[model samples]
Target: MSTTTTVVDIAPVAEVQKLSLRAADPSESKPEGKAPEQEYRYAHLLPHFSEDRYPPLEPYEHVDPGHRALQHPNPRSFLDTAERVIEITPQLGTEVRGINLAELDSDGRDQLALEVARRGLMVFRDQGDFINRGPDFYLQWGRHYGRLHIHPTSGHPRGYPELHLVYRDGKQSFNFEVDDSITTTVWHSDVSYELQPPGLTTFFLLTAPPTGGDTLFTSQVSALKKLSPQFVAFLKTLKAVHSGVEQAEFSRNGRRGGTVRRDPVEHVHPVVRRHPVTGDEALYVNRQFTRRIVGLKREESEAILRLLYDHIDKSADNQARVRWEPNTIVLWDNRVTAHSANVDFRHLPDARHGARITPQAERPIPALEGLDLSA
Candidate 1:
């Protein structure tokens, strides 16, 4: 069969009717999968727990076997190492230098690992080239302890299925616009919201905004030191309910284009958690996901939680703010320090982005193993 050749022009016509169309009316686009930012209205919900109403928090009175109270006064000696270790905060956190992490010999790596276990945190700055190696570098450093954390659902990096990305996006992706501009607010250790929280969080920042985006770290041990004697005693006897349900619920169904449903896991951790490595006790309550005091009445729980939250949030001399330099890697003991990122740079189109490797801890321990709480 012979077919006739035909030409079809796909180009637009040169000239047609000159119809004037009014500019398409502009419409505001609400970000997808995010709730409208609402003002926090819980200030009035706090209960006042004065000394007359509630019992005072007493000092710890118990002592463990083979450990004596006030005998070893210097806890800093636990972190001393031959390698260069510089204190970043008066109470906690240290930066180690004069060693190449990329090429650490087996013995050198082992020594560094021991120091990290003791110091709570170890920082390396001006290592732009080292971070370029990406997850491999983290694996190299973390292999001795454990593998990296794989998040159950959200807060993971894009195109890096193997590596968890801790970033915030405006619309379709995970959004937290309602709260403060910072990414993480309320002083907390990484993944403490989970039933089994990660042990250590190692973050390497490849890019940071010119201004803002500083990470503030404070020692929970120092926080415990500042608390009134009565509060410490009260916390020792209480347990707080921590749940990942709130964030999991939001991620799964609360917003549009949400992820799969995951049940909230609840675990009760001590209000004062002791460090398994360094043997220092720290105030462990955080404002974000800690729901209630397990045995207390609702009113009593509210009263004490308000006090503890305020105590940790205050800006004090013991707090240290690290202005991130490009390619700086910070490894913090999730068991010891509470950190919040300064989010002043949210207005910028491109802000801070990095890869984080969090390893799960074997178990949580008290800072002072032998301290008596019943006294």
Candidate 2:
């Protein structure tokens, strides 16, 4: 399997590195005698969210008395401090308690990188960044991991080119022709059409509804593991066409602003991918971006894709849900998990908005257990 270099493969190093980050003023007031770090602060925006929107609540603070929480083990990989991690489930999802997502020191940044790998997604509740300042902190969080990824279609935030917009107005619908029950709500790994897709995608939920704006997650590792050995071996022999254009957009309801590139970028990837950092194998197919299996009849490809989609998405046991709170941050590895943000609140009164940060792309490398990934 020879690899070809595409426009997506080569990123502008000089252009990306030269990008400036918004920082604080030397004359700005600080509490007591503390000093400011070199990174960006709340210089660009104001605290606009009303207090009633999202009351910053602590973990178990809002819970009823005598309601016990799940006891979880300390986080395993890439953690600078296990003391902070509170695992939500054995499969995936966790909250790295008692830390400010809006700001992180050098050591804190390193711990975050490890934490993202250990727990497929790390949730930070009641973050100051999402509440007050615009996407400045979110941009810093992205650069802390790697070179920030700029979306070709999604527009950037004001003064912050690194941050992408992730907003959904409940007043609108993708396909008004069908029932709200039949939505384009299929689970997907973010931007899988790119040969080198986003390594990590972070979402800072600035405004969540009074009820029902939860996002679902499933471990692709768990999905692949569910299949038999014979099935796994057979899948490794196939490749799939992944495109984020018209076909994929329909699955997503439709693109924001209804802008579509006539010739959208596309790529081919293996059914199995090895994590660049963790080296774990994951099922790479998703109903949203993956179009068809290569070298197969259209009928054969659709049948297989449908089967794989059901296996990964339909199983609740392999999944976890994050009920959103205003100022909540959820960062997940695109290499290992598939996620779907629920639109159950579409007709409801509340509106949702968030700033997204995606680190540099990780070229998908195929691997399987007991087999050499690079042949």
| Candidate No. with top lDDT | 2
Put down candidate 2 lDDT per residue, 141-225, tens digits, no spaces. 5765666654544434445555665544444322212244576457888778765777667786544556776888888888888
The regions of model 2 sitting more than 4 angstroms off are 1-84, 129-133, 159-161, 173-181, 247-255, 260-263, 368-375
Using all chains and alpha carbons, the TM-scores for the candidates as numbered come to 0.69, 0.71
Candidate 1 yields a Cα-based lDDT of 0.54
lDDT of each: 0.54, 0.61
Error of 1 at 42 (Å): 41
Give the winner by TM-score.
2
lDDT of 1 at 327: 50
TM-score of 1: 0.69
